[model samples]
Target: MAKTVLITGTSSGIGLAAAVGAARAGWHAVATMRDTGRADALLEAAREAGVADRVQVKRLDVTDAASVATCVSEVVAEHGHLDAIVNNAGAGFVGTIEQHGMEQVRSVMEVNFFGVVELTRVALPHLRASGGRVITVTSIGGVVGQPFNESYCAAKFAVEGFMESLAPVAASTGVQVAVVEPGAVTSEFVNNVRLDVPAMLAQAGPYAPALRGYVDHALKSFGSDNAQTSEQAAAPVVDALTADRMPFRIQTSDWARDFVAVKLTDLDGSAVQTEMTGWLG
Candidate 1:
C-alpha cells in the first residue's frame, strides 16, 4: 500500500534525482519524461539506488493536455490512488525582450507556466481523493528576475504567483502545495538550452554587450563550486512530498534561501535591481 507520486521531466537533473529519492522513501515513483528514449540514465540511477522496482517510467509532455490527462489517469488507474505530483518539467530561455520573437516568448510560457497549470488542473480531483500534495521545482529566478532572462523569469514568476494563490485553496480540500526553488544546480538543464554563443553574439544588435556579459557571468556561476548537485537540490523536494507540515515555499539550499530572501525583504525593489545589474557587467 505504498503511496504513489508522479514526477515530470525525469530524464535528468532534479527530476531524475527526485524520482529516485521518492522511491527510496517508499513511495511508488512514476518517473515521466517527454521522451522515454532518454530514460536510460534515470533507470540506471534507480537500479543503483536499489529502488528500480518502485520507480516506473512513463511518457508525459506537460505542454500537451492529452498527454497530461492520459498520464495522470494511467497512474491513478494502475496504482488505485495518486498521493502526490512533482511538476519538474521546464525549459530555459536566454535573451532580452526585443531580441526574441513573440512566438519564442509564448513558447516559454506554454511550457513553464501553462503546462504546470494544465497538469495540476487534471490531477486535483485525484489529489483531493487521496489527500495528496503538489511539489513544483521552480528557480530562484522565479523570485528575483535576472538580466537577459526576461522571458524565462516571467514564466517562472507566473508559476510562483499561480501556486501561491492556489495553495490556500488547495489546503481547504486536504491537499498541500509547495514550490521548491533552486538557485543553480549541476545538471543538463543548462545544456538543454542549446545556446550558440558565436551565432548569437554575431546577431546581437544593441543588446550584444549585455548578452555577452550575462553569458560570461552565468557560465561562471553555473560552473562554480557553490552550485548544488542535482541530488542535493532534489532532497528538499522529497522532503516536501513526505514532510509532516509542508511549507508553501521551499529553497533547496542555503544559497537559494539567501538569494530569495533579498526579494522577500525588498520594500522598494531597489535591492533586487541593484544585484541583477551587476550580472550585466
Candidate 2:
C-alpha cells in the first residue's frame, strides 16, 4: 500500500516541496494550503515533478480549528489512514519587542505555534491508529534567539518544546514526533515576514545604525549566498520519514547542522550564550 502523508502550508516553500518529494517516493501526498484558490503554482510544480497523480491539493488554515478538523477528516476519509503529517506552515514577523505589540506577537504564535499544536491535537487519534509520525519545521532561531524577530523565535521555540515533550509520550505509543530546523533555504520566507514597527523605530535610522547592521547580518546569515532551494531542503525531511532509524531532530543545511551541533555539544553553555548575546541585542 502507498503510504499516505498529509502536509500543511503547501501553497509554496518547503511544504510544497515535501509533498512533491513524498509523491515521488511512492507515497500519497495530500497537500494543503491556506487557500486552494491560490495553489495553481503548487499544482503545476507537482505536475512538472511528474507526481501530479499522487498529489491531492486541499484547503487548510492551521490557525482555524474548524479548518484543521475538516481537512484532517477529509484526508483520513480519502486515504483511509494517515501515515504522516508535516506541520510546515509558518512565517516570520520582524520588529523590536517594544515596537511590536503583544497582539501582533499573539497573531504570530496563533499560526506558527498554537495552530500546529491544535492540528496535532486533533490529528492524534488518527495518527496513533496508524502509528504515524508528526514532523514540524522549526528554525535555527528557535534554538538560539535573535533580535528583531522575537515573535517568530518564540513561536518556533514553543513548537520545539511542544514536540520535545510529545516525543517521549509518543515513544510508548509507537507514534513518532520530530522537528526539522533549517537555516535558510531559498524560499519566499523573507519577502513574507511582517514588519510591524513605527517609522520612528526604523532600522535605517542614524541613531540605530548599529542595530540595523546586526539585523542585516543575521538575515544574510540565514542561508548561504547560494543556499539550497525548498526542494533541496526537503531531502532531509523526507529522509527522516522513510529512514530505517528515526532521529528526534534533523537539521537541513550545513549552517543548521553546525548550529545544532554547537547547541548540543556546548556543555559549558558559555560559547552558545556568547553567540546568542549578539542576536539578543
Candidate 3:
C-alpha cells in the first residue's frame, strides 16, 4: 500500500508544492486548505505534474478544533491511515509591538502557533500508530527574532519550542518530529502577509523611521535571488517526511541556515542583537 500524507495550506506556496511533490514521490497527498474553493492552482499544478490522480484536495481550518478533528478523521477514513502530516497552514504578520492591537497579536498566535499545536496534537495518535512523521513548515524567523516581525516571529518561536520538546519524547515511540524552516520563499506568502505598512508606521509614531527602513530592507531581501521558489522550499518538508534519517530540524537553504545560526550560536546573545540593530536602524 502507498503511504499517505495530509498537508495543510495547500492552496498555494510551499504547502501546495509539497502536496504535489509528495504525490509525485508516490504518497497519496491529501492536499487541504481553508477554502477548497481556492484549490484550482494546486489541482492545475498537480495535473501538469501528472500527479492529479493521487492528490485529493480537502478543507482544513487548522485554527478550528472541530475543523481540525474532522479533516484528520476524514483523511484517515479515506486512506485507512495517515502516514504523516505537514503543518504548513499558517499566516504571517509584520509590525512592531504596539503597532498591533492585542487582538491582532492573538490572531497571529492563534494560527501560527496554536494551529500547529492543535493539528499536531490531534494527529499524533494516528502518526504514532503508523510510526509516522510530523513536518512543520516554519520560517527562519522561528530560529531568530527580527525587527518588525515581532508577533510572527514570536509565534514561530513558540512552535519551534513546542516541536523541539516533542521530538525527543516522540522518538522513543518510533514517531519522528521535525520542522522545515524556509527563509524568503518566492511565493504568494509575501503578498499575503498581514502587513499594513501605513497603519504600522502611523502607530509606530516614535519608531516610524526605523520601522520604515527595516521594512524596506526586508522587502529587498525577499526579492533577492536568495529567495527560494516554493517548489525548492517544499523539498525539505518532503524530505522531512520521507527521508530515512529523520532530522529534528532542517532548513531549505544555506542562507536560511546561516541566518538562523546567528541566533543559535549567539551564546552571549550580543552579536545577533548588534547585527539586527544595524539592519533595523
Query: What ranking emerges by TM-score with the best candidate at the front?
Result: 1, 3, 2
Q: Which has the higher lDDT value, candidate number 2 or candidate number 3?
A: 3
TM-score (C-alpha, index-matched) for candidate 1: 0.98
lDDT of 2 by residue, 192-268 (tens): 66333344356435436545555556556545464678887888878977976578888887768888788788888
Cα displacement (Å) at residue 154, model 3: 0.9
State which candidate has the highest lDDT. Answer: 1
Question: Which parts of model 3 are misplaced by more than 4 Å?
Answer: 187-189, 194-196
lDDT tens per residue, model 3, 148-248: 78898999999999999999998888899989999998645458785677877887888888888888877778788889999999988877777896888
lDDT of 2 at 177: 91
Poorest stretch of ten by lDDT in candidate 2: 194-203
Model 1, residue 79: distance off in Å is 0.6
- What overall lDDT goes with each candidate model? 0.93, 0.82, 0.89
Candidate 2 to truth, TM = 0.91
> Which residue pairs of candidate 1 clash?
none
Candidate 3, backbone clash total: 0
Question: Which sections of candidate 2 miss by over 4 Å?
Answer: 187-189, 194-207, 222-226, 267-269, 276-281
